[model samples]
Target: MDLAMLLAVAGLAQTPAPAKLPLPVELPAVANATADPTCGNRPALAERATCVVSTQAGVEGVLQAYEAVFTPQGWLVADASGNVVIYMKRKPEGGCDAFQVLAFADGEMAAPAAPAYLAFATIPRDICQAADPNAAAPAQ
Candidate 1:
């Protein structure tokens, strides 16, 4: 290769890579909600991505809050039951990502006007499948 071409190649190799942005997993802000460390954190691929929040909205209200915020953002409701809901969305890089909410309100029974603890977790597609064999396979 020519001397100029070699120098250019070396410069390109030494150029610092662009800084990575924070993970796309974060809970939507809810009225009268605050972080609740009592639920602790769950580990993601790189770090703890689970967020436990305390709210007076109750379990049903928390579910509604998440549905309202995430549905418009392209998140699909994967599953919803009595006190738990899971939402899934296609990741920007590839595959699917899941956001799960588990509510523990007033010691198991969910009652309106009582304090509720909601655990929000972000799980990558690979981990999600490994954790549950029956889970739908991620899109290629």
Candidate 2:
């Protein structure tokens, strides 16, 4: 191979593979929404990683966009408390996993008209329930 072709091949070989996100789903294309690449790659069942979504759209718009992306992929709106929306999906192993999104507008934190933050956290337990016995409960 020529020097240029060899360099290109070396660069391709060095490129890192994309991390496997915990939810294994894609975010919706909201207007002016940009995601920080270092988030939502946690593979542990109990651990949660948050991907901040910087968007010019307001809080409502962010939530709507997430709902559109998550709903069709078998995720249901489990709860919406203030700026946070919890989406739950049933696991095939007789349990549930959840994606919790917390959206904040410009005025909520930092400067005015700042980027809206969409923090996503996934948990193995259903957030709709009052308690999760398997997680916090003492073993027999």
Candidate 3:
């Protein structure tokens, strides 16, 4: 074969394999939480936050005092005086959930406690449903 033709064929064979690119690693979505007193009264969101706490605690003792309040369908714990002391809420749209630990010593309108927010992406509804047959499936 002609030298030019041989060189051309060799060049084609040497075309470096398409530069391999790290497979687009799809990192799992992470939930970001923050404090927001404005959400104290929101129900759905609150429950979601409390759920995150319940899941994180992974223990019954710390969560024993808190009751699952459905009005806002979140977690609530009352002090010995029977006052709502802690509140938790979730913001699915915001990709986070938050908790409000009330301060009784402080005056009536005490700001939410520090690190009051714990944000986490909502756990896939399917996970809950699959784990518990009674769990309601996420709305389509």
Candidate 1 vs candidate 3: the lDDT winner is: 1
Better of 1 and 2 by TM-score: 2
Who wins the TM-score comparison?
A: 2
Give a tens-digit lDDT track for model 1, residues 31-138: 656666544332221133344454444444555776787888888878766555677776666557776665554333333465555556554344345556676767
What TM-score, computed on C-alpha atoms, does each candidate reach? 0.54, 0.57, 0.17
lDDT for each of the candidates? 0.51, 0.52, 0.27
lDDT of 3 by residue, 1-140 (tens): 11121111112223333322221111222233323332233343333332122122221222232232222354232221222233334345432232333211112232333222221122332222244567565799
What's the CA RMSD for each of the models?
18.6, 14.1, 25.3
Q: Tens digit of lDDT per residue, candidate 2, span 26-99?
A: 56567655665442232231133455555433545556666787778998878765555677777677556776
Clashing pairs in 3: 31-120, 31-121, 32-119, 33-119, 43-72, 45-90, 46-89, 47-73, 47-74, 70-73
lDDT at residue 111 of model 2 (Cα atoms)? 38
Q: Rank the candidates by TM-score, best first.
A: 2, 1, 3
